[model samples]
Target: ITVSNIHIKSDLAIGEEVMDSLAPFIVLKGQDINTLEGLSLRQLEEGIFFMVSPNLKKFSRLRSLDLQDCNIYLQEGKTRSRTIGRAIMVRTLSCFENLVRLDLSFNYLLGCLGEILDALKLPLEFLSLRNCDLNEDDLECLANSKHALSLQELNLSKICQFSIYDNDRISSNNLFKIVFCFKNVKLLNLAQNHFQDSSIPSFCEKLPQNLKKLQYLDIAGNVLTEDSTLQICKALAKVKTFQWFRLTCSNNLLDEALGHLNQAHENAVQAKQRICGLLSALGRTDIHIEIVKLSYAIFVDLMDVMEL
Candidate 1:
């Protein structure tokens, strides 16, 4: 059941009883619901702003909940610390005992990280908070979450304050901490966070030393440049579990793109047998590549596209 662009104007129009019989998966993206005044939706009106399904326990069988781009509004007022916000956030989420995947991406969920992580259950496999105005505190909460080990896929793309650079270092450190927590994660997405070449050295030092289970990684649109490409390759060399790695390093130095590719090829040669695919997945019409090594089966299929 997908419920996108839904409008719930009337209070308690959808009674608590209606939630008793819900499907395993419930998606409520781009919803325009005002207040959770009724339907048993949990509301914490204490000087802080936060809200969530209070009656989610009723949907005991629900395994997945998606609230992407819902534009959820918090009650107005400034809270001194994250304690109250975390408590309220936890209260809203703790009821979903059976949830395996939860996506709250593209929401205005500011400063609600401590509670969200504190409230998260241990059964979750996939968790995404993309573009949710997350801060370093949220990443810290995740790094300390009890369910971190259970997560298979984690998405933190575009989580930084794009307009400011004051908190970039803190956020980057917090992100690396969170990454270290989920040792068993299979797929990770950290795209478009603007962690430029300067952060590569830290990435090399903090990134999980050995993620044997990691398969797919997407670090595209991270403002990575040709000079940083080799640093990235060197860092990735530690992640021996990589199977399919997609990178988008364009627009910064098209002339030096081939040099970066050659360096990548040299680095990739070390893991040629382990890597099933290594795509420089970008949207460039002018760029081209030659079949430098036909024996490397991964590049065989991509050979045809190299000319165009």
Candidate 2:
């Protein structure tokens, strides 16, 4: 199942039987093929994008699919506004009737989300489109998709990084588009999206009311100003639910590449504690902040910046 770096042929066409037979053995990353509940297609040529598993008739119950960095994008002649949706990859994904977790990270899906959502039969509970070269309009499509009301977890981490050539970064307005759209999201990860403290202070004021059901928020890796960080602290105080939600923020500085990570974590902890202490002194002791580390799905173990 570890089919990486294979240059798919131009005339490649998989029949129903071959696709079904390959489906069961398609769920493996590194050495764990024992749990055959998902399929991960990664590190392949562009031709592999459309020819991998388009006809998995026998694999109807497959619930998870990971197509990370396979250079995914819509084919030529396909426009976003047109409803002529027969994209090969989208059609392939429609085969999964019970898929709840879908990770299409590290590719180029600029304006293809609409067709993918149209092909899906059920509402996805967990969706990770991290670093897929998505634009504002693509986010708009996902926001208005059929799964918007039912989607619980969304990982848009690193989408602003774009792939190498796409120089455009996701702005704060685009960030709030997700907030204003996915109202029922419980876990939201916007880590490493290049936030420069332009409009976050004002947006933090509305964060509580926007994502009322948010339980775990990973805002780590974006270097916001100290005042912006404090603004987030004040915003969390007005969550109304008084329920505990895990929060993580970037260490906001780095002396070297991954070298000052521990210090960053320590510094973040101290900064948050100082902010919360100030709030407590002003009779805002209704909230509690603690530090803990946990692994987000597929990402590295981020030192939990703080907890509440």
Per-residue C-alpha lDDT of model 2 across residues 1-308, encoded as one tens digit per residue: 54322211122236754453333235322323233456666554555555545434345666777776666655335466332333566667887887787888777766667778778888999899877776666777888898887888898887776455443455656776576578888778777677667777767877878878766666665666667767776776665544343444443233423555687677657866886786676566765554333223224422221220
Q: Find the number of clashing residue pairs for candidate 2.
A: 0
lDDT of 2 at 112: 66
Error of 2 at 217 (Å): 0.8
Which residue pairs clash in candidate 2? none
Worst window of 10 by summed lDDT in candidate 2? 3-12
By lDDT, the best candidate is 2
User: Over the full model, what C-alpha lDDT does candidate 1 score relative to the true structure?
Assistant: 0.53
Pairs with steric clashes in candidate 1 = 42-54, 86-115
How many collisions per candidate?
Answer: 2, 0
Per-candidate TM-score against the hidden true structure: 0.60, 0.70
Estimate candidate 2's alpha-carbon lDDT, on a 0 to 1 scale: 0.62
Task: Give per-model CA RMSD.
Answer: 11.9, 8.4
